[model samples]
Target: MPLYKTLDPNSQTHVKIWKITETYEDLLQPLSLKPESLERVSGMKSELHQRGFLSVRHLLRAFGYTDLDLYYDEMGKPHLKDGMHISITHSFTFAAVAISDVEVGIDIEKQRDKIAVIAHKFIDYEFDYLNKYADDYIRNLTVIWCVKESLYKLFATPGMLFREHFFVIPFTLEDEETISWIDYKGQKCRFNASFLEFEGFTCAFTLPS
Candidate 1:
């Protein structure tokens, strides 16, 4: 089943989350496919690849678009001719997407305690900010991790370090979302990121403003 959530920042955008609950045959729906795109979907088994295609199709149907009018840029960013921005993500059992006139990114992550072990790689000055929260530390760290990953996807950059290029502004646990930004090579982009706890997983997404 797919879960749908709306961000309050922009009334025009919609976010959808899909937890993989169908088999390959059921989710792919080969009998209902167009030949060319069907061939493409048939060629992969990486869960992420399959879910990406399916998620878009799910959105298309939801929006009353039946022909799958989508294309990808050289950088592999998917675009719609009718002009809506899109972002996609998937994990072992979940997939997510957000579409809006504004650029956006969404990420879902299984909440794990081990995130602390590798924090140094993606974390830079942000460590100072995180260090202030000594209790429930792992949960907060996972939030930062997901927020940075979403920002990187939104930025579409291959060489960004979460810790070095972006920062999540401090917010309390009661706050569902927080402010974050990327200062990449002096180019700045601000993002509003939010996370919700889902069955032991933490999912976060960013909307560019």
Candidate 2:
């Protein structure tokens, strides 16, 4: 198995990343999926997406769980039958998961120049510190996007707008970590955000501070 990276941010949390190098058939060989999961994978039109789905199952197996032990909530957030909090993410050639005793969220995104084009869509207050001409602009933007996305998954609240509600504290690419908040509907919660880049992709994950 191509388990690319494993991290224990805390004693109670586990993060696993998989470099997706296996064919869909090879990825499917070692696992059994729930009927719903099987159906969901079957309906995915892209073979890459199917492989990402299967790779997630492999991650679950690394955590000593199986597809049968997982389910999605009304908000489409993933949960474990044993009650541990879980979050999932996959992009291009990678897939990852974060599970913790406390609520957590994870996101992996391919670093792309296109993120700069749509930066306004998810960024508002953050614009104050972002320099579009900086050498690390794309990396910084990817981290911000991933931070907001992970916060969204953690909140799992409907109608949350990334630009309006999610805010990531400013940090340089060298910092590799920052703080973020969700300010929505008179409620505010803080989280610790951390990120790393590998093979042209950026991965960020958050846990309640």
Candidate 3:
């Protein structure tokens, strides 16, 4: 498949998503990768992850970038050699990239009942509004997790924990938007977060609010 979706959340931020529907070999055939990137993908134990990794490279091409143009820092945060802020995420069958003049982060997750089992680990303040008995409990949990995951990626701080430092304001699925906070070490920051669900998967991203 080609680029699955493109979004301009703000004038300065651009996002591209790819639906992974090709064989690992099919994905690798077109793109030229940096040696380190080839090494990274070659070390993957699962072909699915290998395909996901390659699909993100295709996404960089959609953004007019090549693998040589992307690199990561000691914190494992991704950067574009041109100085554009960049973030990458891939889960299951979807891979996405978000680039901006300002820092930004994006995440995609497959919705599943098991997310509810680990909800406590990443959820604390959100528990105040969550109702386990609700029919959409799992869906809401997935959205919150996606939002927080994006925040964690954007912040890129060493010791931030989702359960302890991140907070999401109350929101409904229909709105698909929320204000999230990072209260780490007394340095509070906020972001405008948005999310959408498709084919039983949820995708979310955040930019400075």
Candidate 2, 1-209: lDDT as tens digits: 99999999999999999999999999998999988999999999999999999999999999999999999989899999999999999998899999999999999999999999999999999999999999899999999999999999998998999999999998988888999999999999999999999999999999998
- Candidate 3 regions exceeding 4 Å error are none
lDDT score at residue 78, model 3, on the 0-100 scale? 94
lDDT of each: 0.74, 0.95, 0.93
Worst 10 residues of 2 by lDDT: 168-177
- Which residue window of length 10 is worst by lDDT in model 3? 1-10
Which of the two, 1 or 3, has more TM-score? 3
lDDT of 3 by residue, 119-199 (tens): 999999999999999999999999999999999999888999999998999999999999999998879999999998988
Residues 84-177, candidate 1: write the lDDT tens digits: 8777777766776777788887778887767888888877776766763587677788888889888877778777778788899887667989
Order the numbered candidates by TM-score, best leading: 2, 3, 1
TM-score of each: 0.84, 0.99, 0.98
lDDT score, candidate 1, position 36: 69
Give lDDT: candidate 2, residue 127: 95
C-alpha lDDT (0 to 100) for residue 62 of candidate 3: 88
User: Pick by TM-score: which candidate is best?
Assistant: 2
